[model samples]
Target: MTRCDVDSVVQLQISVSAKRLLRRADGPLRLKQIQEMVIAKLGRAVDHQQLLDVLQTSAKNGVPRFFVDGDMVGLTQRQRPGPRGCKAAGESCPLQPESFEAVATQAQMAQISKATKKLLCSLGGCMPLDDIQDALRVNGWDWKHEQVLHALQKSAKNGVPRYVLDGDMVRLAEGPSCCRRAQKHAATELAAFLQETEFSSCPWNSALSLSSFRGHGEFLQHVVQDERHSDGRPRFEVRKLHGADWIFATESAKLRQQVFEAIQALDAEVQGRPKKLLDESEDMAEISRLGKLMQDWVSGASWLTCLNHTTLVDEVPGIMTRVHLFDGDGIEVRLHMFMDPTETYIHNHRSNFFSYCLSGRYWHKIWGVPDGEAGLDGGHYFVVNRAKDPSFEHPVGKPGHLSVIAAHTHQERGSYYIKAVTPHTVQPQMDGNVATPVLTIYIKDKAPGPDTLVRVANKQELASLQQQQREQQTQDCRLEGRHRLERLRAMHDLTVLTSHSALRKKPRAGVPCKPSRSSPDIAG
Candidate 1:
């Protein structure tokens, strides 16, 4: 044979030997190890570079047989067959390996339970069972899918389960308390930090990394956990402003005002205006159209200019902050920041209005109650005469049991119209890291009369309402001119910061402007 023919025959022999060596080995081998093994199997004097060239060429060409990573070389996944029960070639078998017993030991079960709890806590207390099993396998546990499911089921039957299965979803039963504890712990740490420092509120990350805090992992868990009261109000004072987290003391009024102001400012700049009003007959369509327009509006002249005009900021502690954005010619615009859910009472507005959600989400329930049944059928009803007494000091009449006509989760950028006297209540959802804020535009279609007719499920709730009114009356005196203006100024700052951020994300088409200042300390 010619010299070229001999070279081809030797190359073929080397390729076969390399593949056989790799197939017998358990894992990747170094290039030198592979070369030594290949030469021994061939029982001939083979050039090292020649063997490498053949292997490298095989890996680089179509249908690569082996992969070369630096000096390490191993058979490509496609070249190897997967283990038993694996659906695809070279994929990790989801089923436990043959060496592992079909049933897990007591010690293995304990380990699984512990790992599952840790996973649940890290995953915000809820996840699919399949996902949990996959996570376990990835973490080196070889428990079968059936074994993991069995362990979870057994634990759930105990007096207090680490997790409960809902269909295919596994949820931590103590999720609320877990979050609450985290919140309390975080608040305590933050309060102590603030007391020692001159700052009122500290950036979330900086606080987490403090050497004094030490518990970095624990602090992160505490901060990120979603804390909410049984009533669905946010329990944590963690606020996200200008795209950064800020941990504020529960009583840090000045810092709270700054955060609120930042939100108002950003919202105003991003708020859109409708091109034309849809006839009142198509109220839903009209509201949606207006919402889209508002959401789509690009940053323009600062809405902060409008803040200078007549404005009223009102607050019902633990309930809502109502800011009168505009009021004229039988029309009113208001921005409402909700701190608590309003599901305790069902009521209707005096005027038909359009509401748009800027951030967070809420469940809006529409009720249908027959007339004159106002306080009958075991329901406590009251006439909220806002026109006669805007303070809501006294509820005049009693109303009756109501049925839910419709309900929907109102999400960000969503808008809806509520006709005058249409019974409804807005209950903010508890999925957010902070309280939700709602912006509403009220159009007075009719002259003011009885502002609202509120119905409660029981007398206990009616008593609660009376108690709330008394507390509100006491707090009303505190929301004075200075406080209102401070809120407005904060809102202005928020708008500027938000608008600047939006501009940074997507510069307004061709318009060019210098970047705005980095977010200022809200406490300042």
Candidate 2:
């Protein structure tokens, strides 16, 4: 047979499920390695397309279609030879390569540039724009000034990870006097200026010395060691003795960041410790970006798209994760998973749910129209969601009441579910020895009043079942408490006697066992 172009059939590992088939081939072959697998199954000179053609065919017929899919290929009982014959057959197999498992190819997994890649798991709202820029520089990466500004703009809380000294490295300060001379000279000159001129004209009546300076506030205090006037006369530069100036700055929410720092400091004080900073090594910009995305996901509202049906309670039997609750109070998305979805009912719009299985090993099913279930028209469904024919505003299922359903349908498990727009009822179950799905009634805008009003003909049996549950619980608690008390007594008895044995046994050291002189005497 003529082979297809070599470029079209890339040399890739066969799918994991396909490799087992190659192993059972009657001819000797290296089935593990891709290159060796093809050569071992066919002659070394066999064209690559020819090998792929066989693989493709097997892939199609594999009962469990692509391992990810539910359809999988299973060898029939007839396909399996006797144990003795199989071992003998293995000796004559052409499979040789051991590393034949298929995986996502490099081309498929190739990542885009770092610039385009979205970051994950980051703190929102940290630091002023300028500080974030410095942090990136420390890591030897240059960030555009505008990009950093944009990051700072997005966060509601602009806070960055604190920088701490490394445990392995010694942290010696830029050691005193780096800018102390500047501070000292500035104070001296200011004092002279005050004496020569009016103290009111001076910014301060009292001068601040280098000794008065603190970190950050002091570090940026003196940018220039010495500043000169136009006449070349040495003019003392009075540093602010505080962090950078924020007056009239263009950094968005600069003041907010400062307030946040103040709050953090106060919190640290209440905790009876200084705030500790971790590695100053984080991309504040990317952290800010992810923070924004998370914020948007939370803050933005979701518009519900209505799918077909009202009062359709579908349950997949046996799936413990069947009770999948989809809840959104317009802020949080809550999904409660159970073995069966039908075991749930909407009581007061309790929750909505939908899901589908991608793998069949865990069998599931959903009972619904199933091709020909007649619709209960004018049933309970919102007019907003399904607008095509618009469901009536009245709630379905006997008009604000509970319903029982037993679902037994479909061959493979059901997953891949979606419930949107309005809250709906769902439960899940697995295949084999199918379990029933229970649904609690949903009473919107009303407190749960009571259970279904239907009276059971066998009241005694119902009471007995309830009594059995309560008894079992009480018995378990009593047994646990009894065992606990036994352990406590055993542990305390030995220690107590040992600690006070002399007190209990001691009566009188020199006196007889008879009465004492001051006490009543006993006659013989």
Candidate 3:
């Protein structure tokens, strides 16, 4: 089925589930209870967050007729069905709400309870009794300390998703699983081992030599076990980022080594044959070959998971995917994926890198301060020393062979080299629901300058850009254009006021931004 069709079905099922759960209830139920009931009745896996999103949407649309309270949900007056909607006098009604005891017998419910316990344990082994009571107390269980403790103890004894600690401190008597101790040991050892031996590369950099680490076997075993017994939720930080086994270290290194060699060979040929002025087509053809090579290298490798810390710089969009394909002694390969309507703030990198667009097209721009001095003052971009007046700086050479325009085309599925000091930004070509994926191979220089790259656009410029986007969106807005326009105006006024306050605090002198010690890095 289509995604929309599936979503519609899920929405209807959720609504039906809510109605059945509240059919005979006299008051509100905790969201947790509602979630448990919904899952039990549907006999399918569903995310609690997903349920919340759908419920919120339903409320906005005036369906399901439920409202949310603090961790609780209640049926609206119109939604509380009468007893006539329940099953016939003797037979049990599937639509009628069941006590937690009735649902607890199910294997799925037991597993969920165990997961909850594990999550609580991860936060801290010990929690207040009140919080534990809320978790263990299912429907029909009186909110008594003794009853909650008894229920948890019974479950723990069954060895079905058992908990080691189930008392006033809401502790885990047992770990998440039988080998949880080993898993924790491996995870800890690997994290420490990585810090010592691995380079501080972003997720978009290559995976360091995991096999070379002392406890490689232990780490691999832990990951394998974690993956095998995973219950959807993450138990540790690494799992939350890339799960347990997104990529095999040995295989990734081997493939990356091959790609690096090929790139080296290409560079040698280009350098040796400089007399044979290469056309744009020839350069692009070479890039296409490299792209094919990368595809072959990643034929069996898993590179879809997020690989790096995304917050490389502030004010960058959080929707992009930066995956490191290969990191070698003097080079690194990365895959960058940008979602629709992306307009990244202007910034520069600290290291030299060559990028090849693997898919889609984008508009790129790069601006550099003349004489390496520039700053913002009174809502305008200026290039000058702190002692002089501000003026605009002209663009230096760009990566691609293109004339000056509003934005350069970071396209052609071909490679182009960008210098370490060059400042640049990219945005979706049409600025709508499109994705741009690029592959970049960074060449680390032995003596690159201190890389202190910072955002060049002042608050005023950013605000104006945002306002333009809002205005463009409003032009196409059908049902909500009026409301959006009002919001846009309010936002613009606020921005203006904020900018004025900021201007008052600005130093009226030299460049708005001063170059600091450059480090080896890239822009967000």
Best by TM-score: 1
Candidates arranged by TM-score, highest first: 1, 3, 2
C-alpha lDDT of candidate 3 relative to the true structure: 0.45
**Candidate 3 structure quality by residue, lDDT tens digits, 1-524:** 01122377888798778767766565667778888888899898766666765554464344335544335565543432247454445433332342222223445445544544654544334455566556555533334443343345446455553543321244455555534554554445444443333221123122224422232333344453463313343322223235433322222334445566776655555445534222343454555566545544433222212222231211113334444444444344455545545566555565655566544456666655443232222233422121121121221222222112233566533456556666667676663454543333233322344353433344455355445545443121221335433332332232334335545767668856221111222222
Cα RMSD to native, each candidate?
A: 25.1, 41.5, 26.3
TM-score of candidate 1 to 2 decimals: 0.35
TM-score of 3: 0.29
Relative to the true structure, candidate 2 reaches a TM of 0.16
Give per-model TM-scores: 0.35, 0.16, 0.29
Q: How far is candidate 1 from the true structure (C-alpha RMSD, Å)?
A: 25.1
Q: Alpha carbon lDDT of residue 430, candidate 1?
A: 67
Higher-TM-score candidate of 1 and 3? 1
User: After aligning candidate 2 to the native by TM-score, how far in Å is the CA of 229 from where it should be?
Assistant: 54
Off by over 4 Å in 2: 1-328, 331-461, 468-524
lDDT of each: 0.56, 0.28, 0.45
* TM-score-superior candidate, 2 or 3: 3
Query: Model 1: per-residue lDDT, tens digit, 43-111?
Result: 987665676667755643465565544356666533334455556676533222332235466777788
